[model samples]
Structure formats: structure tokens, C-alpha cells
Target chain A: MLYRARDLISITSFGEAYHNKPYLDRGDAESTAEPVCSTACDGASKTQARNRYPLRLERLIGRITELSGPAALEASCGLLREVQRRRGVPFVWILAHRLPPFAPDLAANGIDPQSIPFVFAPQPVAAAQAAERCLRSRAFELVLLDLTNQATGTNRGGGDRAAAAQRIDDAALGRLLRLCRQERAALLALTDRHGDLAGSLVFTRFAAARRKGSGRSGARERGGSDSCESGESSADYEYRVTLAKSKTGRPGAVYREVLRGPHGML
Target chain B: MAHTACCNLFEFALQVLLRRVPDWEAHPCVALAHDTPQARVLGCNAAAAELGVQPGMRYAAVLEFAPQVYAAGVSQAELHQHQQRVIAGLYALTDEVLCKPGDPGVLWANAAGFALLQGSPRAWAQQLSMRIERLGFRSRIVLGFTRFGSYLVSAAAQTPAVELLQSVEDERRKVAEVPLHAVVTSRQSRRRLARLGIRTAGALVQLPRSELRSRFGADVELVHRQALGECELPAQHAAVPVQPVASRRPPQPLISSEQILLETQLLLEALVQCLPRGECIAALTLQLSLDDRGQRRERIVPANPTEQVAVLLRLLRLRLERAVIDQPVSALRIEAELCRAAVQQHQLFRETVPERSGKQAVEAFAALRASLGEEAVRYVQLVPHHLPERRVQWRQGAGSQELSPRGSVQAQYADCPGTAQMVRRAFISPQPLARHLLRSGKLIGPYLLSCDWWQSPSRRLYYYYVMSPASDESTSALWVYYDLDRRRWMLQGTV
Candidate 1:
């Protein structure tokens, strides 16, 4: 949403009352001009009510699992920048292969690509080791694991089609998940599709649709048809995120955002 | 009175030998000639002297005089190098220094005006003695009005002490107290003076000039005149400038990192020996040649200037671990840039926070960067923009500007009233959700936000403060925005 200068709230003028509190009490609502929620719902309605304010349902802190889609990487970077800005938490992105071609998208959103620390480990074992080292060092507040290529492989039966997919290494995934839990730092794991989310034991899985292995193929087909009809590049494809696992919040929460520019999502 | 200072580094040959083998000082040892047909002791320690084993004595004769004496030969080149180091150490005290090449044990400097800057002559003498001792030598300094007078006094004084003569009369009286054997150059001249009842400088000066000249010849007459302060014995001031650089090349190539470190340590010790007093190393450049015809160079600049070899070695070790050495090292060279001693200033009123040593801090930072990548250490900066998301930025390195809690808010907004405070919990991406009923009353806004009309027409958004039905205290409020063009509800942030 494009916000005009006058419409924006001066976070500084808002004072210590709202900082780090996360929620506004009913008393706070009377003192400020911000709108207040009157009726407090119980149990089943709480889930429905949380869906009304989707941002509140998605916990930005602690360990979070992001089901990868067309714009998943871009979204992760955007989230990192936002968290750093509002909370002053620093993050390190661990890439399993070469840096992504769409890294310039970070710069478009006011983040310097050179200033974002990235540990490139092409091998799954190395990537896990790097993540462990970074966590133990306690130098970074957030660890972004890019498992796009690391989690997918060709089918073991030597199929003629190179696109056949296999599950990622379970042992490495287990170790990484354990390290994340032990370190207790906020971890965001980005994958190519929701079907490739079998390895992690700690993630509370979430998918846009409650379908099996075919769910990813269906989404891809839909995205392909939409882009072809509109004559738009694959980069413009839309992404629908599903929380598969969350250590602190509810699972199965779906979020949708449009992939815009080279590296960010709106 | 004009002041002259003479520094006598007693048993200089022994001192130089002891610097290399310190334990030898306890034995009745001497540096002797091993290759000559008739082996001779070149220098002897106090223990050997007690047994009548002196320099120029044959090695056989020395052993016969003192059966337990230890003897070894030291090359003239080695002695000269050590003497040069001692001279370099002295340069830090004064510019005017005199040393006879043939007798490096004795040095004379013009100390006439130094007393005003260095306090009393006795204190200056003691300070100079300490400087010499730092260079691995023991010395005695004597201050007097005449060069010969000061030399005589220093030669007679005990080792590691300073003696100052207040005036020429005092110097004369001190010189007269010295025995004829100590001042005379030859044994024959000393025996002749002793036989003539001239056992001391005072008795020698009491003789008739013609009789003394006739009996003792021109050399004795000159010595008598010098001792009595009648002759002008000019001390040729030989001021050797301090060496600016020192290098060491091992005889064999080093194949192991440990070997290289050992060699580098020896070279550093040699270089430090040449450093002027109160000076330290500021920067160092280490160059290594590999067996594969390739070279590597690394430069290390300590955050705080220091001459401690341990600190420098620690940094070098860290750099070397990261260096990709394709082949064995053929040679290594280290060049140091010297700077004045560092002085750290601390705020008196402020409470002191416990801090890690500079070396430790640098090491920790390097380890962090290696594991997490270069951009891991960063600071936040404010950027000018209308969007709250674009109004702040993170840059590498700890910024000089303090991000005070109040300052952070002030920097974010210009018209901020400095009263209300708010914290933003942002989502990596705004989440789209299905329409759901809210237990809380109506939403806060329809606050219209539109910008960038020239580039794209889909720039309109309607933001609202929606209260979640969840009873959980953490996720109770959310800032949601609706895209007018897309007609979809998106979650922007949590408050």
C-alpha cells in the first residue's frame, strides 16, 4: 500500500506505550485516536478473528517456516529488511548454492546487497555446518536458510525426464532443525514448493491448499496459464505462502503477496 | 661547570656473550679462539678473573689458572653487531655520543646542557644506565668536567652505579685517588711508577716534569698530564644513527607453519632490539615467497599501537590461517613501521565498562565474519523517505553515531511530537487472507495512501487498524491494508 506522508503515524510520537507490547489494551484505545476492538471472542471465534488480522497471526519472531513459491525468496528478503528496521535485529542469509540472480531486488527496496551477509554452501552438509557455526557465534539475530536447490533432486530411478523430484537429505535437515531449536534464534527456511517440506521435524507445516504431492504442480500450472495469457514474464508470477510449521504460533495460516520488481514482493 | 659523561659498559665482551647465552654468566667462562694454532681466551667473566684468567691469555693458560673455567670463541663480527645494538639503544637518550672502536666498553658523550633537561647529573647517569641495561648490558656512568676525568671515574666505580663529580677540583681529587696501574696503558709503565713511589695519580703528578719525561718517556708524560687535567684529551664523538630496518633470512627454507613462526619471532626480536627507547611498532607488512614461484603479502595494522611481540604474532597467526598457501614457503620477510608509544585517555567521571583486550576483540570479530559472512556486523541508519519501510536502513560496521532510544524515534520522523511512541512488528511480505468476522468493533481506517502516479496507476491503498479476535496478548492488533486495484486484503504489519 502506498501511504501518503500525512496519513502515516509518527512511530516516535506514539511513545513507549506501544513499543514491544505487540497488543493494545482496551484502556490504550480510549487515550489515542486509533480504532479499538470492542467484543472479545473466545476459542473457535479467536481463530476466525485472527484470520481477520492476518499479520497478527503470522509471528515474525522465533523459528518460522516459509513454504516457497514463485516470490518466496523476495518475500523473505523483504521480511528481513522490515524486521531489521522496526526491531533492529540483524540477519544472515545462508545460500546453498551461488547467490540468486535476483539479488538486485534487495537494493530496490533500500537494502544494500553487499551489506547483506550471505554464507554460500553448495553442498547440503556444508550448508548445515555453516548454519550451525553462525548460530553458535550468536552474531546474527536471524538465520535465513535457502533450501531451494538443496531440498530437490532428480528421481533415483534414472528417469529420462530431469524434472522428476526426490526428497532432500533427512539427516542434514534434522541436524539443522536441531541446531535452530538449540540456538533459539529466529530461523526462516525457504523452499521451492510445499511438497519438498518433508525433511524438517521442527517446522509446523502450512500449505495454501490441503492437497497431496500434486498441489505444487497445480499451482505451477495455474501460474503458467495466467502469465501466458497476460504476456507477462515468469518473474511476475504471484506467490501464495502457507505456514507448514510454527514453534510459537498456529499452523496452516495462508498468506498471499504479489511478486514485484527483481527482488521484492508486495 | 661544563659536564662530560662517560658510560663504561663493564666487561662488554662478556656482556655481549652473556646476552646470547645468559646462563654462561654464572660460570667462569670466556669467549676464546678455537681455530688459532695457539687457542686464546678473548674475554673472561668475573669468576675467571678471580683465578687470574684474563683476556689475551692462551686458552691452555686460562684453563690451567682456573681449572673449572669455561671458554668459547665468539667471532669479531658478532661482537661488533651487538655493540652496534648497544649504541642504537643510547641514541634514544642523546644525539652526541662517542665510542672508541677499539674499546667499545667505554663511551663518552657531551652532557654539558643535558642536566637542565634531565635533572641532576647523577639522575641522568642512572637513567642512561637503565637504558643500557634494557639492551641486555650492565654499565656504570660517571659525570665530570673533563673527558679523561670522567673516564677515570667510571672505570674506577663499581658496575651498575653512577658517580658524579661536582667540579674540576672534585674530578681532580677523584682522579688522584685512582691507582697508577688503572690509568697507565702499559704494565711496564705502571711498574716503573710503582717502583718510583708513584703508586697513585696524585704521587705521579708530584714528580718533576723533566725527571718523569726522562724516565717514563713521552707516553707516560702524556698520561700524567691527562690524569692531572693538564692535557686536552679530545673524545672523538662517534654518533651512530639508529637502524631503521632489520631483516633476517634463514639458511634453509621453512616447510612448516611452526618453523616459519619461529623464524619470524627471531627476526622480530632482532628488529625490536634496534628500536629507539619509547618507540613501538604501528604497522607490519609480511611477505612470503612460495616454492611454486608465487608470492603472498599481508599487512596488519593494530588498532592500538604496540611493540608486544605476542600481540603481533597472534594477529599474524589469524591471517596465516586464512591464507591459501599453495606451496612450501621459501622465504619470509616482515617489515615494521615504528611509532611513538601509544597513550590511552579515559573519562574520569564516567563508569568504566570491562573491555576485552584489543587483540581479543579483533580476533573475535574476525571469527564472526568468517563464519557468518562479511555483512553480519552492521549498524542502522536513517534514510529520507515517506514510506515507514524505506525511512530506515542498515549498513555494515558499528556506526559512530549513537542510536539512542529517543534519537531513533526523532530521526525517523521530523514532525514527531516527542510524546507518542510506537513499535512496528513487520511481516516479510503482506499476507492475503479470506474475509473473516471480527469480534472487535469497526476497523480504524480507510486511511487513503497513494503515491508514484507517474510510473504506475495502481498506487492506491486503504490501510486499517484491525483488531484480532484472538485472546493471545502478543497477536492482538494488526495493521492491514487493502489494494484497490487487486481488491485483496493484505496484512502489512503488527502493532
Candidate 2:
């Protein structure tokens, strides 16, 4: 029973475009027909089948496991990292064109930055690690991309500045999109409300009842003193989330998660 | 080194010097020896006659007849130098100079441009002859408007002309009475003629054209033309192209990377100049020398002749950079020859279009790999997993085409986990079945394979799975199988 009931969660019209398409549902059908399913089950036990909608994480993981190689997983890592950052992170309006400081931090949380893996690496060590592990060992659970700083480090004034700008622009975003489209890894890219993630499924954050100073929720607790700056309150930063892109999941549904986190995030 | 009077006479001189002269280089003359004691003189019978000495005359008889006669040896090097100097002088008159080493110095100069610079063509010949005489060499010079007439006149006259052909009138006069030997009579033909009482150029010229051709073949027709000075010579020039010039200044008197690069650059530049405009290079030759005592190694690189200097430089750089310096090239010289031009035909619509997808894929892979690591990208291929401890896989790159025409590989599992299980629970060889396996109790498996005959053979086996449930380690699946036909047990793989 590869068919899933199209009820349960309220799928926005936009979300239906991502998962309700015939092609999107066909992936599940293909997975069911794999010869490995018979070998894995040993064809001995009878199990009850359940109807599900919009596909589940388990099914997506299976597909990802089947499609992903080192390169694909590396791309997924970039997407997932973006998603994590978009959930909740501090915003410092710094124009410095260099890799952001929290990239390693995000990667440490199991968000791969590359399709493969490498032990002794410099920048994007997490990407290398993911690539090596995924490509060589054929093992990848998920991939996250954090593009909050994708635009940084590209404004170096030099020859053919426009061409350089365009190339960099495409690389920062286009590579991520292509990776997700081709790889089996489930990509989750996150970005702020105003920041453009190029190709990603956007979601909104909820307005919390717990005030910033009161620190009622865990997100508020994380937002410590000195979190507010320049007379503008944390509430002033509107958290707008919308699904920009989704291959196997909902896209338009505005699933709101609060921006407030421990130690301060906007 | 034997001296000679003319390039045309070089062969005659060589044959005479090598056979007749005992120490041709040292003596530079042949010593005349006879039964009677006679003063040795170097001249042949004809020369002896000029000195009032007959062939059979004793040396005393020659002295009595011509007491002032001077006997001198022939210097081959002097003759060679004289020929070269004549050639050089002729080149000063025009740019087209063709001198086949052993051939008579038959030069063709285009007087169309240099007629005024060199004075009248007749004067030029006289001046050329005088110059040769001043060099202590003898020469003859003749000129006409046509090459055939000039050749005939020069052969009939005493020497070659500075300008072989100058005008129509001069050509007509010189060509009217050419000697038969100038046009026909080779050694064998001459001997045959002699047997038939035919002697002298005038006599052969007198023979009827049809009868001469019938009896003597093409030689008769050649003689007839030469006699009438009607044979046409292709218009050519006389110019001694500068001797190919190459020099090397090596650091530490040995080859170095910098030196190699510089030398290649210089050679390429030199070749660019050597090749005519619009002409491309067909081939290039590079010769390297180790040192004063080093051996010379020559390398020939075939390339399209191109007027584009940059292309030549690039090619040279590539060749030099890849050159293996077996011995330090203390000296190097490069020469290039012209080749035919290339003609390109384009399709209707295809232009200079770049391959976008392929380029992007590779660059993206490279960039990601460089920024990330080598393991950043991976390929997926199908392989066999025989046992619990063993797993085999293939590598398929992102750009690799799926369904590689190679049939899908299938791993067959046995029906029952018996002794066959033990055999299956072992390492499966990816390589061909080199050897067979057996067990203590019963026949288990046989490793069978068929593959690339050149590389190795592919293998197919009936594999079985044996599991150890209680081990602290993960359940190790062992692939065991039996060669049903061979009645043999073979352990193929373990996972």
C-alpha cells in the first residue's frame, strides 16, 4: 500500500504544489517496488499497512538513502544548515564579506556542509566529513544548509566585477538547489524573513506570549540581557516564514516557530 | 681534400683523385709514373699536350720540349671554397639561388629587378669570371634571356654566368649553336657513339632527329633540343639563404629550466620569422647538445604551420615544458618547415558554443571538492554482498551514464543454510575465480567467473548466508555456496 490519504494536516494550496503532485507521490511507489524490500523483510512476516499523507520522515529518509551520494549529501548539508539558522539565530548587521562565525557551530550540530567527508580539513570541514562518510560509506541520514552568510565574502572589488558577482551569486544559491534536486538527501535550508535563500521552502515563526525579559519559553530564556539593541525591541523583528521550495514536502504552509532562543536570537 | 675547377667537374675530379692520386689531400696532384725514369707531372694527356708534352713522352722529353712548365697539385678544398664564393657572389645579384652540391653551379637569377643594379648582364658575367680568377680559380660565364639557351651557352663557353638569362636577343644567339654533349651523351652513350665513330658535340647534333631518337632513345631528343638551345628552364632565382643561425648561452654551461624556456621562446620566434606570412608550420626540429663533448639528440615535433605567433609560442612552451632532459642540453637549435594550410567547413547553425552543463558539473564538483574535500563527491555502483561481513559496491560518478550497457549484476542466495552456509560465510573474490574451496564433511561451493578476457573473468556463485546470533558484535552474515555440478563447496563472500 504505497498510497497515502491526503488528509491529517491542513496543506496550503502552495504546499499541495510541492507534495500533492503526481510525480511527488510516485517516488513512494518506486520505493515499494525495490527488490531490497523483499530481502529486508525476508518475505515471512505479515504487517499491517497504514495510510499516510504528504509522506513521512521515514519514507523521505529511505528515498534519500537511495538517491544520495557524497556530492548530493554535501548539497543537502548546505540546505539543512540554512534551515537550522532560520529557525532562530542572532542578527548582526555586519557588512563584512567573510564566512560567518556560527557556521562551524551549526555543523557541529550534525548539519553537514558537503556531500562527502574528510577528517583533516580546513574550512567546510563538516562538508568534507559528510562527503567522505556519505560517498565512501554510503551513509547519510539528513542534510542542512545555512545560507545566512551566502552573500558575504563576494564583494571583493576586482576585474570583471559584474561577472564575478553573477558567478558568485549563482554558486552560493544555485549549487544548493541543484544538490537538493539531484540528491536523495532531505535538504532543509533556513533564512531570515528578509534574507533571500534563492531556492528554499520558507516557514514563519510564532509570536510568543512569553515576553522577552520574562523568559517564559525556552527561546525567551535563551534571549538573555542585552539582547535588545538600539532601542528596537526583539518583537519589532517580524518573523515571516513561507515555503519557497519543496521537492517531497509541503511548501506554502506557514509553520511558525519563534525566533527567540537562549542567550538571544532575532 | 681535392681541389676542382667547377661544380660540374666535381664528380670527374673525385673519380680521378680517389683512384689516381696516392695522397690526394697531401700531394693535391697525381704523380705520373712510367717504365722509363721520367719527371712526374700532375696533368692528364690533354694538359700534357698543352705543355708540349705527349702522353707517351718521357719526363726528359717534356722538359726538352717545354722546360718552363710548372707542375702543381689540385686542391679540393680550394675548389669547394671557390664554388661557395661564386654562389655567394651570385646571390648578391638575386634572391633565388639553387645550388645542388655536386651539380655544376647552374644558377638562375631573376634579372627583372636587379638588372640596373648589376650593370648590363654581359658585364656581370665578365665581372663574375674575373672575381673567380682573382680567387685563384678558373671559371666560364654565359648569359641569355632563357634558361635553356643560357645553359647551352655556358656549357659551350668556358664558365657559368652571374645572370644565366638576361634578354631574348642574347638568348636566341646563344641557343642557336649548342654542343650535343651539353644536351645528350652520358658515359655509356658516349662510349657507344665512340664505337660507331661518332665523336664531338657537332657530330651527334648532325644526326637526324627521328633516326637519333629511334637508335638512342630520349637522349637523342635531349641532344637535339640542346643543339638548338630550345629546351626551357623554369624561371628561378639565385639567393644563398642565410646559413641557419642558432646559438645557446647556458647557465653554468649546462641546461636549466629557465634556459630551456628561454631557448624555446627564442626558437619559436626564429621559426616565426623563417615561415613566410600566411604559411603555417608543418614540422619543427629541435636538436640538443649536452656540452662540448656531449652527444646530440634531435626531436621532431609535427605541428600545423600557423602565422599566429602566439600559437607557435604555446606549442613551443608545451614541448619544452614536457621535454625530458636526459642530459643537460648545453646547446639547442630549432628549425621549422612550412605545411599546407587548413580549410575549415562549418555546419549551418553551430557556432562557438561552449558546453555549459559538462563544464558546470566538473567545475561545481571541483569547487565543492576543493572547498570541501576529495570525498565531497561520490559515485554509486552495484556490487555483490555475499556474507554478513562482506559488502561490495561500484563507483558511478554524477556525470556517468546510468544503465552502463553492462548487464545488472545479481547475487544469488542458496535455498537452505546447510554446510553451504559455512562456504557462503567467507570473503568473495572480486577478481576471477583463481582457486576452488572445500570443507571437511561435504562439498560446499565452486567459484565460477567470466569477464574481460584482457583484464580478468567475471564470477557467479550460489552463495549462502550463515548468521552468528549470539556474538557481541553485529550479526555477521557469512556467504557460503556450493558448486552443485562440481560437487564442491566454495566460500565466496563474508559480510
Candidate 3:
């Protein structure tokens, strides 16, 4: 029954500022037609729904994981723009070992490379240090850690290489999470997919989910079947974002969107 | 009678000569020689004097006497230039200043009716001494009723300043006590006087006038007359016009880093104090002489025009830290150039700009470059390109332009509607993978992407979206791409 209700809310809230509007407007008779036994009961249910699918824009202090591909890049850029719009003067810092060459595509999609500050670290340790220092200063509002190169260890041996790579990734993620919590700065860690899948693992301090399972919570877009109607379309790519950890909203929440552009822009 | 004050700077040639050879001063056995092919020793400091080096000895002969002695030759041109600087500096104290052509170290000024402008003759003499000192010369001042008497008193005074002789009787008493060498021009006559047991002026006066005249000629007679205050010598005022003079002194040789840093700080402070009102130092040039006689020069321009001593010192410290000094520094010279103070607009009520902190950050970065080497500090520069990786470049050192904007992304992309927000994780190199199956979900693939046809043939790629088999959850997705030309499936990145 709860799953059915959650599906209804997710479908109706797409591209709408439903979370921003007041849950119950006293003058609106349409709100009263929802068969409310009591005003307190209706208010409680409304609050519960809001908490289950917190607006992505309002989740300022959280991480966004880009499941690796061109589609992930496009989605991150779009999310960055959204954050910038909502915060007004949000200073975003992109910390990476090396920046990809698709900056022009980002510029074409209205994400200016010149507008974002990039801190390049030659190694993973350096990137971690830079991110920690940048966040501690609170000089930047959003810090994106490009772990794509860092998470993949050099293939020196057969079994040890994979284990070592996983260890590096886990350590980097743990350190970044600690820094984000201490500074209360939003940190997103991006890594490439090892298989034929792409998705985001978001770690946020705002919404702490009570559920324990790893099931998809809300708003899942199926595939990269979306058509490219306008702008420069390079390829059709789809991405899914999962709220892996949150301090204020549902932790296991997920959202999916398809991007179509020369560089995977929506 | 009008009183004349004479100011004599001791070792003027040696001081000015030391500026060119910084390490020579540290050698106890060092002498200045005239710049002739023969190179006759003009003056020897106490160190050389102790080693039997005497004035007028041939440079080669002095080396024979003390092979360890360091001999530096002073050109006539350089000596004359230094002499003119000293005269011009003293000229500022009085208009009626007389500086003899041969005696470049001494200056005679007519203090007659100008006592009120200078407080008193003694005060005027002290002021003149300070002015000469500012020109990097050590000076002694003497005041008397006659030019020769003043000269005698200045030459007799071992200390930097001598008492003023208010009357002719006082001048006569002081002159009688003066050594004969102080009044006599000829070294031969002074040596003759010493041989005859007449070392003091009083003893010279006691000798029979006919005998003195017969022994030393007319010059001895005039010297005796001047010593007795019987002959009055007029001051020969300088004919040349006075020009603005700048003082430059080579700092004492400092071997320790602490001493070097301290001396640099003092120099910076002095430079700041010398700056004109409403002006600050724009650039500084530091010239250092090494022990091996090699020279090292460094020029530093602050990120912001600053008169603050601490800021300048900090930058210098950084520079010194990174500088590789092969030998101990023997001398240092600091020169500062002035510029109009930087003017910044201030918001009336609220803070609109972080100009002060921004400037400090730039200065800090400069210091970092100095301490950590030039490659330590880096800044990002964006290049216009279609390739995502080639579009950004990191360069060492801060550029003049402002740091890239931080919050303008939204306005920049506002025109592009329905743009999917995404972040791409780039791979160092795309990892090759084999075609695999997914347990949690079916594979979603073959999305093709190809570009850059001009440089190379257009390479085709087939991308697929599948769930990781190790993870049971259907939510986890991975992106895989197939390179057609390479004929291989590669894990491009994770979504």
C-alpha cells in the first residue's frame, strides 16, 4: 500500500516545485477533498511524503555519484547547474587527478569551465588532502572528487590488483565522507563503471533514511531510449542517481534521467 | 673674523672602493691601489698597515711584502665620482662650500654669518658630518676662525667630531697641540720634522724660523704661520652647482643566514622610510656578491604596491630560501623603486569585494613560489577545445587575470533547456573488458558515439548499461563501451 502511494507522489512531482509549496493551504478547497479524518492526520501524512522524496535541489549537503560514462558527466553538469541556481553564489570546486577534455561540450550546455574552479591532484592522497583543506576553509560550497582514476589500481598482479583498487576506493570515500560531515560541505565522488551499468551513489548529511534495505526508493528512469530533439546531440545516454546515504531524507532514494548530446548533455 | 668649518671623511676611497669588491673588506690583509699599470698602493687599511703595507708602495712590491694581502685598484674616474657625491651631499648644508680637487675627502664651508641658519658653528659641523655619513662615508668635523686652522683641527681629531675654537687664541692653542703631519702637506717635511724631534706643532714653532725655512722651504714657513694663527686662509667656495645626491652603501659582509636576513630586513625598513609621501615601492633589486667574487642579482615586484616592511621581508625570505648560494655572501646592495600607491574602490556600506584578502592570497602564492620552487604553485587555465581533457591546462605561477569565476555556471547554461545534470568521471586510459552478462538486470547497449574525423578516421564506439553481477541490487549500473577499430570491449566509466 505504501509502495503504491509513493509511486503516485513520484509521478505527480516530476519537474514541479511540489516540495516548496505549503502542504496544506487553508483557503484551497481542493486540498480538503483528500478524505482527511483529522487535520493532524493529514499533516502527518504530508510530512511523511515530503521526507520520503526530498527535493534534490534542497539536498545541498550531499554527494552525487556519477555511474561512469559520458551520460554521467552530462548529469553531473546538470546537477551542478541546478545547485548553482538554487544557492545563488555557490562556489563549486572540482577536485580531480586530471580533467577530461569535454569542457567545450559542458560550455555549450551552459556549464562554463571557466566558471568552475578545478583543483588537480596528481595522486589520490593529494586529491584527498586538497579536498579536505578546501572544505575545512569553507571556501567552496560544493566539492566534486573525481575518483575515476584513483579507484582503478594498476594491474600488477591478478587477484591483489582488484583487492588493492577496492581498498583505495573505500579509503578515499571514507575520508571524503568524514571531511564533508565535519565541514558540512556537499561532496560528490565520481567513479567509472567496471561493467555495463551507470548510476550515482549520493552521501548526504541532510536526510538520514530509517530503512535498511538497498532497494530502489523512488523515480527510476529505465533506459537511454530518449530522443535528441534540440542542441548538439552526440549520443543518447541514460544515468541513474541513488541516494546511498542521507542524514535528513530517505537514504536509499534513487532518481534516473536520460541525456542526449555530443558529450552527453540532457 | 668669520669662522670656517671643515668636514673630512676618513678612508673615503677605501669605503667607495669596497662597494665594487665586497669580499675584499673581510680579508684583514687588503689595500686600495691607484688604477695605473704599475698600481701604486694609495691607502692601506689598518689590516694592511699591520702587515708592513704602506702608501706609495708598488702593488707588486706590496704583494712581495705580504703575499696574502688582497689589493683592489680604484680607478681615477670612480674616485672622482665618489668625491663629487661627498661634496654634493655636504653642499646641501652650506652654499659657500670649498672642496679641493686633489683632497676629495675634505670640504671647507664658510660659517661666518650663517650661524643662525645652522644654530652654531659646532652644530653646523655636526650636521655636515651626518650629511657626509649618509653618503656612506665616515666623517670628522672641526670648526675654527681660519680655513687652514679648521683643516688642522679636523686632521688632528681622531674622533668623529672636534670642539669649536671660538677665538684666535683657542685656535692657536689647538693648533700647537696638532701633530706636524696634520699641518704639513709634504710627507718628506713631516718625516724630517719627526727626525729633528719636532713632532708637535709647538715644537715646530719653537725651532728657529731661519732653520725651519732653510730645511723645509716656504711651505714650512706657511704651515708655521698658520699654526700660530698669524696667517689667515680664506675658504675657496665650490664653483659647481649642487645636484641631488643618492646614498648607496654596500652592507657589511654577512656569512650567517640569520645576519643576512636581519640585514635585508633593515635595508627594507630603511627603504620604506625613504619613500616619498603617497608613494610605495613597486620593485626591489637585490645585488649580492659571493665569496668567489661572483655576483647574484634578484628582482622582486610585490603583487601589490606595499610599504609594509613585514610583507617585503617575507617575500625576501622566501626568495633566499630557494636560492642556491654556492659560496657565502660577502656583501649585499638593495635598491627600491617607487610607484604611486595602488588605489582600490571600497564599497560604502557592505562588503562587495574581497580585495584585501585576494591581494594577500596572491602575495602568499608568490611567497610559496619562492620557498617551494616555481613549480609548487599552480593555477588553472581553460583552453577552447571539444575534447574534455584537453580543454583545461594547469600552469605554474599566478596569472594577472582573476581566478576563474565560481558561480556563473547557472547563468551560462540557462539558455540550454532540458539539459541533464551529470558529472563524468574520466579514465586515465579506457580499460578493455570482455562481453559479460548481468544477473540483476538485462544489458542496455549499443549506443554509438564517434567524432574527431579530421585527425584520424572516425572511430566508432558501442556503449552498454548493465548491473554489476557481484551486487544483488538492480540499482547499481556500470557503463561499458566497445571500440570498433580496436575490436575490444572496454569499461569506459561508471554511471
**Best model number under TM-score:** 3
Kindly list the per-residue Cα lDDT of model 2 for residues B1-495, writing each as its tens digit: 100111222122333333434344332222244323364443443344555664334556666766654333333333333445566666665545544443434554444555455575555555556665564444455445555555556667653334354356556554555544555536667667777766655566566787776667776667666556566444333345334335555565546656775776776777667643334554455667675556553343322234555654544554454346766766777665544344432124636633222323333343343333344344322234332222322232443122121111111111111001001112213221223222222222333433344554333454323233343222222334444435444443332
Better of 2 and 3 by TM-score: 3
Q: What is the lDDT of residue B229 in candidate 3?
A: 63
Candidate order (TM-score): 3, 1, 2
Which parts of model 1 are misplaced by more than 4 Å?
A1-49, A52-69, A94-104, A107-137, A145-184, A189-237, A246-251, A261-266, B1-252, B256-284, B299-324, B336-365, B368-495
Q: Report the C-alpha displacement of residue B318, candidate 1, in angstroms.
A: 5.2
Tell me how candidate 3 scores on lDDT.
0.56
Global fold similarity of model 2 (TM-score): 0.26
Recovered share of real interface contacts in candidate 3: 0.20
- Indicate the docking level reached by candidate 1: incorrect
True contacts kept of each: 0.00, 0.01, 0.20
Candidate 1 lDDT over B46-128, as tens digits, reads: 78888888777787776565778766666554565666677777776666788865776788766766766787767777778
TM-score for chain A, candidates 1 onward in order: 0.54, 0.31, 0.52
Lowest-lDDT window of 10 residues in candidate 3 chain A?
A209-218
Interface RMSD, per-candidate values to 1 decimal? 15.1, 23.7, 8.1
Instruction: Determine which window of 10 residues in candidate 3 chain B has minimal summed lDDT.
Output: B241-250
Backbone clash tally (model 2): 101
